[model samples]
Target: MASHQNLNFQGQIPGEFLIARIMQIHASISKLESLRPSKQVNILFSHLVKLCILPSSIDIKALPQEVQQMRQSLIILCARAESLLELEFATYLSKISLPLNDLNRFPYYENYVKLAKLEYGALIENTGVAQLKKVAFVGSGPMPLTSIILASQHMKSTHFDNIDIDETANNLARRIVSSDDEIEKRMKFLTSDIMEVKEKLGEYDCIILAALVGNEEEKAKILGHIRKYMKEGGVLLVRSAKGARAFLYPVVEEHELFDFKVLSIFHPTNDVINSVVLLRKSLIYT
Candidate 1:
């Protein structure tokens, strides 16, 4: 029965259809403002956290004011990094954090690793980013957005931007960051597809790509183009959605342009259905 269903999904979930499905969900959330405050907050917070309203421990208080307030209700802790905020998967947000079992929506697995102290620290250390400036992140939804904000503060050179192809994602990211006093004048937000990065290439020193779509060709195209955006010896951090690894793992292994590596793999101690991958990138062209 499961095999038959997987085959059915494979038959129907083409690239265009998958993109359209994402757009539809975006549209539904856009209209969610009409719902009651309780409902609105519920929906928005769910979307926000799922999209990665996280901060490293060191940067939590330094986060944009709006984002801090947005995260105020959630149960998160401070990590060793001045900018790092830890999400205790065993305590809160575990269900939404690890939604891999669900077939209809996109999920973030890195949140699961944030639950594991041993793995989380290793992931952060493995990033090899002693300093970061002019950071560019694709898939600025949840974990990536949090990372962009945290890394920007850690570098402190000013000028931070989290760019995404989804207008909804960009809008949500802006709303999340708009309130952070620490990020004022230091952060810029953009909504654009990663595929057209050539126009904006050479503007960033580091590029981070987190989250995976089901399409292997699209993923490779994204990775291949992202390197063009970095200066010589710049870094790229890429993480795949749990289900995407079956197809994407081999591609990452074969790709020569990126110094791709897994930073950490997170599995929710409370929820077996959810898992996340933290990976790092280094540009090889330089």
Candidate 2:
């Protein structure tokens, strides 16, 4: 039996998805109304738990392909759970380089944790970890968990701060509340558009933009706008599905704001699909 309870906010799932599940649950219950009394009750409980728990469990992986597809849209369920696990046990795992015990608390962390344990945890075996500080996330979704995990390991502070213009992401961001100790103190969760947030964000030493825009034009526009806010000699790390070439090649030909140079290019060794591009933003000389 599946449960229809509202899941935690993580990555990209929105309230609409929850509403849809409720509708589906209602329809399923209606279907069982004509059945025998005992059968109807059993079916009701079964559907309830199936609707709720199946989407969140690791056992969903072992289920048939058809079963997985039904819940694919709700993938963010696992991501948010992982974020909580990492935050909950940061103190105990602070000494270890990659905290498997903590990460395994949630299901989505499996791939990332495996990569961290076996393949230097996506930071060149700790070099990138040493360099990270005051990390500011430009996008929120499943990536926040990964970002928070990285920040917990390396950065002095982590900010899941995005200038959300997208309604869906804004909804998810609104649901995210930080309870991870000073995480709330370090976090600047805001809902304004990017340019607007820049005014109050000051200049973060390390700014991370994870697929902040849709295409090259939007990316370029945001980058141009972002230059005004980035500190001198600071690093602006960007992750994109289109790859580093999308930003790096164009940045050279059009040096309007800050100079863009590709500092690092590496893909996450785990299950995530996007590649990481670390670009250094040269301070503008007046």
Identify the leading candidate in terms of lDDT.
Answer: 2
List, residue by residue over 12-127, the lDDT tens digit for candidate 2: 33434543553465456445433333555445534443334222212322444653343432222222322344343443344454443344554346544443233223343423
Candidate 2 CA-lDDT value: 0.45
* TM per prediction: 0.46, 0.47
Mind giving the per-residue lDDT tens digits that candidate 1 earns over 81-145? 10122122111222343322221121334433342333324334765544545666565542233
TM-score of 2: 0.47
The model with the greatest TM-score is 2
C-alpha lDDT of candidate 1 relative to the true structure: 0.41
Each prediction's whole-model lDDT (CA): 0.41, 0.45
Which run of 10 residues does model 1 get worst, by summed lDDT? 75-84
Candidate 1, residue 208: the lDDT equals 57
